[model samples]
Target: MRAFACPHCSSLVHFENSVCLNCGSEISYSRPDRAFVLTSTGRQCANLERAGCNWLVTGDGELCDCCALTRTRPADDDADGLAAFALTEAAKRRLLFQIDDLDLPLAGRREDPVGGLAFDLLSSAHEQVVTGHESGIVTLDLAEGDAGHREQMRVQLAEPYRTLLGHLRHETGHWYWEVLVDRAARNEGFRALFGDERASYADAVERHYSSEPPAGWADAYVSAYATMHPWEDWAETFAHYLHVRDTSQTASAFGISVHGPALESEPEESEKDFDALIETWLPLTAALNAVNRSMGLDDLYPFVLAPAVLDKLRFVHDLVVARPAYVPAG
Candidate 1:
């Protein structure tokens, strides 16, 4: 979520910008370069016609890296569904951008058919769709894109926070569990912090919905939903890490510091340092919540991070940073 500037005019631009307003230069995201570049080659993603994807084609005039990860999308004839799909794709692009920034490995079905990253952006209009991750495929219910429908579900489910971006971040956590955590060496440390994931997932879910979290859940878990299972606790905490990292980066990019100059210092690279992340995150969120209250809006960050939760977040941070950059075998 760092600020992007147009290469041609040096004007501030957005990640989703197609045409630079200042210089009128056409823009496209280059996967290899990981930045918005001037498209002198006139190459656009194959999905531009149907999905409004603005990323540059990587090769052979086909789908871009982000779009290629999508195994299925809503129907073209379904206008509402198509609109929702666009929003979902935008959020997914943001997610992928951060993933790339962290230099995490991304394997598609083509690379590993058995277990690799993929997406299923399904519309729930025709049928009920459960949003979850299985293997490496993440399914999202498109109806969540609609503001009204999203709010309705948020209230019904009694969730303090929910959004398209949050869903992508959360589900991708599950995908990473398979890629990064489901192993003998990693599982030992993971269990010590997040509890043994071997516990029956089905039973956990049943118990969670049938009742409520045990007393003082907030002191132990980030959210009530996190208490459902160890896997869920990991995903929820992982999503919060992304949330904190990205938002803190945005704040740094904009020269935002909460305290006065006497206390103000250079922004820390939150992606690399957990202490710096908490240092910047807590103050920023508090100020942000106050600003939202001034405008009669809810708190931007509704959850609190206890000492125990901070330990879990640190675990996620360490695991992510410790992993070597993903390089495909030749």
Candidate 2:
């Protein structure tokens, strides 16, 4: 994420800040300007009363673009569910910000009822909610917002790292499959890189759960879960791409640099170049892991990027950069 400052006091502020701490100014994000503005007159999102969403309403509706994408949410009266919903919405805002930064197209169900993006933040306390994406809608179990619950599931699933933001990034990868990859021009290349997504998804799920991933799975896939299906493989790889880009951007904003004779290459400002991104990422992660170790914490990034995984990442990078220009149908 880019550094944000209070428009009034020029003091550093966070994206989630509604009231600037430095100058006691109210702040709301402006979608068109892509920055937080001091707002006394601008209307706040309708969700502000319930969800504490601070994004400004850009049009006739009271909901902001991010809040409008939420088609279903937990009951307002359910205290626990409402708490979880707030955290989930915060992560959703971060994900949407990154997508906007990448210039990715975002259309909601109202725009394309058949295959536009939408979200269902459900509470598993009442119903058994499985987190996954269907068509263009992504469902997330609000229980995942609880850090303890998330950690328990992470251990059960044998995942190295898992979080609300990671879930959003991974699931959106599925939504983008329809938006970016299913077209005629990209299908052949996508199939070659990620394998045939037409392969039986049901069978793959059964096999993946009934048994263990094949030996050396890491050599070919980003995670064992990714070995379940080509669709998952694409999503896992795409999530990693977003992870790298966002973390790298943060590092650049902080003026963090790795300087040594061993690393002679000069750093660049933009992360669009995959090689440059990977170059900055490896050394940065190494240092990060060391820092975590000193603090008696788990490695910040526990997985390694194999050569095959790198190739898949490159494919995703090229796809995003070369995304076709959107042309609305008449």
* Structural similarity to truth (TM-score) of each candidate: 0.94, 0.95
Instruction: Give the C-alpha lDDT of model 1.
Output: 0.84
Per-model CA lDDT versus the true structure:
0.84, 0.86
Model 1 deviation from native, Cα RMSD in Å: 2.8
For residues 1-330, what per-residue lDDT tens digits would candidate 2 score against the true structure? 777888899998888999899899999887777889977757889887687788998878879999999999987689999999999999999999888878877788888787888999999999999999998889999999999999999999999999999999999999787677884257888989889999999999999999999999999899999999999999999999999888777776667766411222222334557786788788988988989999999999999999999999999888787646542222
* Tens-digit lDDT string for candidate 1 (77-126): 99998899989998988999889877767888888777778999999898
- Segments of candidate 1 deviating more than 4 angstroms: 260-270, 325-330
Number of the top candidate by TM-score?
A: 2
